[model samples]
Target chain A: MSLELIRDILVATVPLLLIFPTLFAFTTWLERKALARIQNRIGPNKVGVPLTRYGGRFSLFGLGQPMADGIKMLFKENIVPRDADRLFHLLAPILALIPAMLVLCFLPIDFPWINNIQDSVKAFMLDGAVIFFFAITGLNTLAVFMAGWASRNKYSLLGGMRAIAQMVSYEIPLVLSAVIVVMMVGSLNAAEIANAQAGWNWFIFTPWGLAAFIIFFIAALAETNRSPFDLPEAESEIIAGYFTEYSGFKFALFFLGEYIAMFAISGLAVTLFLGGGAGPGVAALPWLSVIWFLVKIFALIAVMIWLRGTLPRLRVDQLMGFAWKFLLPLSILNIFIAGSALHLLAGGRLAGLDEKQPILRQLMEGANPLVVAGLWIGALLILYVAANGLNQLSRAKVRPREYKYAE
Target chain B: MSEQIAFWILSAIAVLGALVAVRKRNLIHGVFALMIFFAALSGLFLLLLAEFIAAVQILVYIGAVGILLLFAIMLTERVAGDDGRRMTSRGWFWGLVVAAAVFVVLLLPAIQQWPTPEVTQAPDPSVEELGHKLMNPYVMTLEVLALLLTAALIGAVTAAQGMRKPKEEGSPE
Candidate 1:
């Protein structure tokens, strides 16, 4: 309602709106270049060639490829499959784009651009950002399923099913890893988490932090349906997968949504793990921290591209197995470890750790060490046994005779 | 005023979508409508100062649930049956009466006794505070949720395995 509060909301949201589209564009370019390099072929090298005395040069192997792709997609004919429910087919892409775009609202690119200027403005500001992030990110799965179903193709249907299964499976680990970070920092606001890691002792230094980082990275990969986990769009198996029937701008929306989602995930990971926008001893130049955050995000994105180039697509069963059998248990353990360590450190019971005045910390520390150790060991044993049991169960269920081809 | 206008438009779209979801014979339309409903709900959540919940609502319901429903519908049936007729039988009068009764029941309290706003508290329920609460006093709840999720995973895998096709005894004729 107040001018100052309105200014802050505008400032926070404006940059996000501008930055996300630009980032999405950059990701598309990066993916193409990376994929091309991996395939041992020249890619998109003919665009944006300036006519110089040197007879023009292909710039960055056509870094403007995304622009070209975008233009081409826009002009292409929008085809609705004859058998498709036309109304839903038309709606699905828009539905997908909206949720993907909404995620940016919760992301804290920098400190709240506006302090407490007006009470009304404060209401709009996202304080519990991590929860918002997870909630928004979870919506992408629904968008994907909608696309597949709207296509009315068997391949699309299968792709949708695979995507839903994979996403739901990985979401557990994704959330759990986030919980670990929350456990360590005691806050879910992305900006606050970054602030907490202001100094050298970023959460990444802790044992649980490392585990969380790995879990989050893997889950992000799976969540985005990038290669090694891209069964949803496995070209060889399911053709174009969910978006098989889409063409033109509708198809482009899906494509843009994917890149944007990837960027968002990378931003989230950087925020939670790599001290988002927080630089080393550069607190004076707060803007440089933003650069640091972007650099970290870029590095993460490059790693994802590398993953796409290197790893083969996972079989659906294997993907599910990895999520349920490995990542879930690991995430749970990581949370426990993080919680206990924080408790110990706060109480000063652990040597070289601080003794906090908090009674909760004291209680946790005062508890029997042997009991804690036993519980930890017991958890590990149970996980191991459960994993083995699951493997056995899956093997028994497969029953080799069932898969035999009946000619 | 503009924000309110946007909210009304989005809310209307969402309601329309939900209606279409239930009324349309085409399963795919229903899924799309559900997505619209989610998007609209998310918009509503945003209006309510529950941005986190809004985002999650869209992400999970629109992105995941809508997509899953779409897939299920597509896989189970062909598109030829996608008439604009109702998929389920309509009990219009009874349905309206029931819906109206529920709405009144929910709204009557607010209408009769307007609630007083509480004093603004310090250290507002920010994301950080939520995290601290979750890890500290509510640590046991977090642990329990984790356990519940693990059990669910085990159960899902077991059920999937159980539904696997029976082994073929010999080659088909």
Candidate 2:
């Protein structure tokens, strides 16, 4: 490749490589502090610079903890069992790290922050970026299995198996929800998807979009092995699961990979439904777009942290059932609802609002809110009926418990 | 020149990876090799400017299919070790002969000294056009495929569940 092309690639990639890891470290600290506060304790208070000079006794709130942890982890002993498969044991973490980094390559961070630059400030613009993101991110399951198998430990194997099952199950709903957005926007390009929701026209305001977003977020939680669905590495059950035999830097690699993947997917969710980088003053000052993107991502991450603090871990069977019986069917039906809604609102000849406005703008403006509301209500009715029917079906299969008084 | 070089390298990798995937004795190693094959194939698709197909190729085949293969391998047999038993029966020679025949048939077009067609640059179809095509003329085919997949899923679930004896009768005891 030419030097110019190489430079362009570097300019695009360097920020992502640096920023995401830093964001991840910051998130780790944030989650600890937030979760700690929720549980009525001071978290990570002594790790950073003390703010004794500011009259109060506020420290940096353990902001430096991730950095310290990183250094300590690097120095810690790297351990591998004698009977473990040496090559795959080493290869697994590297494999896990690959897809995590790759998914970030397709995400559009801002809407042209640089002067004399193009419309969008994406790292790379691939027409099929959405699918590409999903494809690469899904490869983590293979890495998990590899790590589990290579460890030659039963806990690791169990962890790996659980990871594969959970990831594969959740991926269907994740993709299905994304497909709904694709249906609405009628493009797979991340930039195009983001741009479609420019201004205050974010998808989350609508009913189907809201449902799809909820499904997407829940599926993302499971896919990333976050709390409530983190059965793969559940501490109490399988003793750290797939990475049970990993130590020091290798374990850190897995941790880094998971957090990065979390950020990357949440970034995608923002781009799709949250009007990525679409905020006040962004239209006039485009550089503010990056800040908007960061704000959205961190907000999503904080919610995930909040979820981690609030919810108990789900049972394994319940987790799988939730993905298949609930999410899969809900997501599939949601695609139809989204399609019908789009057709009525945007595709019809009568949908145009004004003669001068663009078709999309016309559709957004001219579409009857009352009719749209009715469509969503009908969708909600169908969903409620479906859920109720499924619940009754499940209930019929169960025998009621009979209680006897002590004799 | 660079594009040609990339195409050649990717095709070579694809072929070699395919060979290794089939020839490997250990199932997990074979699966990993298959992943390489798929990756190379996707790279080839990307080279052809069929980026959507390339993404789908990687997503479905390498991601989903690889996991499915692993699950099947673990479910049916041990994760490590091989008995070195041939997967096929005594008809291996015929299978090879059939494969060679098929390969020859497939290679016949490439083997001929065909005239180079006048190169015409066509703007690559956007994903919108592709989606329109799928939902329009190909909608029937898409519906059929969906039905086929649903049927397959149901069949697999039933097979996994197996033919259990009536629980009602057993519960009476």
Candidate 3:
């Protein structure tokens, strides 16, 4: 390849490779500190930057904790189970990481450095970029399964099974919810979707968009195996799930992969629902779009961390039921609602609205905004009732646990 | 030159993966190897500029089918297959002969240097174009395929549920 081509490829990818992993390191410290603060305790306060000869005195509130953890992991002994498939055990973490890193390219973060890059090298420039993102992220389940089964441990196997089932179940709602955006924009290209939502035209502001965003967020939380839906790696249940037998750098790799996947999915959510980098001052200062993008991502990540601190991990049955029964139907319905609303308001079908609203036609020639708004309200109500009914229908009627001898 | 290199590398990976999938004795390993083949084939599709098909290949074949195979293997008695007697069938000679015959048939056009159809113009590779084609001209075919898949899914679910009567519950205890 020519030097310019090589440079273009590097310009396209190098920032993502450097930025997200660094963010991953910092996010670990942030999660711990945040979770600790939630629990009324200080976390990682001792690992600060060293200034003096004796490991420095200014312990900057554990800012150096992730670096310290990295070093510790590097020096720690690599452990492998005797009966494990050593090849798969070695491959699993790498497999887990590759897809997570690959999907990062599909996020439309417009850095100034990448502004001059050729379209061929930019992953999100593709017409089916969103679908490609889902396809790549789907491989993460196989890696988790590989780690679980390769470990040759029952708990690991259980964790793998749970991860696969949960991921496969949640992916439907996740993709379905995202389809609303693609439907709205009439393109699957991330850049196009983001551009369609320019100047506060974020899909999240619309009723169907809001519902789709909510479903997408909930499904994303499950997709990343985040808290309230972390049945796959529930420590209390399966002892860290798929990576139960992984140690040291391998374990750290899994951790890094998980955090990156969280960032990637959050990036996609921001891209699909939050108008991507379409914040103010972006036209004058193009680079500000990167800040807006990261800000949106971190905002989503903060909510994830907050939920982690608040909601307990879901039970397996509850997790499956929530996806298949609740989120799936709602997302499917949201697509139809969004589609019909689009056809009514913006699209040129002009199908049945005029005949139904003859009185409104008397007020003005084409004043159908109230009619459209009313239709949206009615649609949202149906969605609300449907959601509640599905919730009621899918709920398992198990009696509360009885404590007779406790305390 | 870059495309050639990518094509060669991806084709190599696809071939090796398929070979390993067919040859491996361990069921799980075989399934994973098949997934590798699917993934590599998707890469080849991407190389061919068929990004939609590439994504769908990974989505349907690797993400769905590979996972299904893994689940099926997990459900079996001896998933590891460590106690395997023989993987190859006793009719290996016939199998090879039939395989060779099929391969020869498939290669006939290329081997004879048959004249390929000339393109009036290069078709747009954009997924939007594909979507228009599918929804406009091929909508019936697409809908039929969707219905067929849905039927298969429902049939599988029904078979899994089986024809058993519901249990008579007397008490919550």
Regions of model 3 farther than 4 Å from truth: A51-56, A347-376, A400-407, B82-84, B114-122, B162-173
- lDDT tens digits, residues A6-81, model 3? 9998888888899999999999999999999999999888876755554435677788889989999988899999
Highest TM-score, which number?
3
- Evaluate every candidate with DockQ and list the scores: 0.45, 0.72, 0.76
Q: Where does the lowest 10-residue lDDT sum fall in candidate 2 chain A? A: A111-120
Q: Which digits, one per residue and each the tens of the lDDT, describe model 2 over residues B16-43?
A: 9999888877788889989999999999
What tens digits encode model 2's per-residue C-alpha lDDT throughout A255-345? 9999999999999999988988889998788889989998999999999999999999988888888888888888888888777766677
Clashing pairs in 3: none
TM (chain A), candidate 2:
0.91
**Per-model tally of clashing residue pairs:** 21, 0, 0
Question: Per-chain TM-score of chain B, candidate 2?
Answer: 0.85
A218-321 per-residue lDDT for model 1 (tens digits): 99999989988999999999998999999999998888788778888888888788877777656677567667877888999999999989988888878988
lDDT of 2 at B83: 82
Clashes of 2: 0
Between candidates 1 and 2, the one scoring higher on TM-score is: 2
Model 2, residue B4: distance off in Å is 2.7
TM-score of each: 0.76, 0.89, 0.92
Error of 3 at A124 (Å): 0.8
lDDT of each candidate versus the true structure = 0.72, 0.84, 0.88
The candidate that achieves the highest lDDT relative to the unseen native structure: 3
What is the TM-score of chain A, computed separately for every candidate?
0.82, 0.91, 0.93
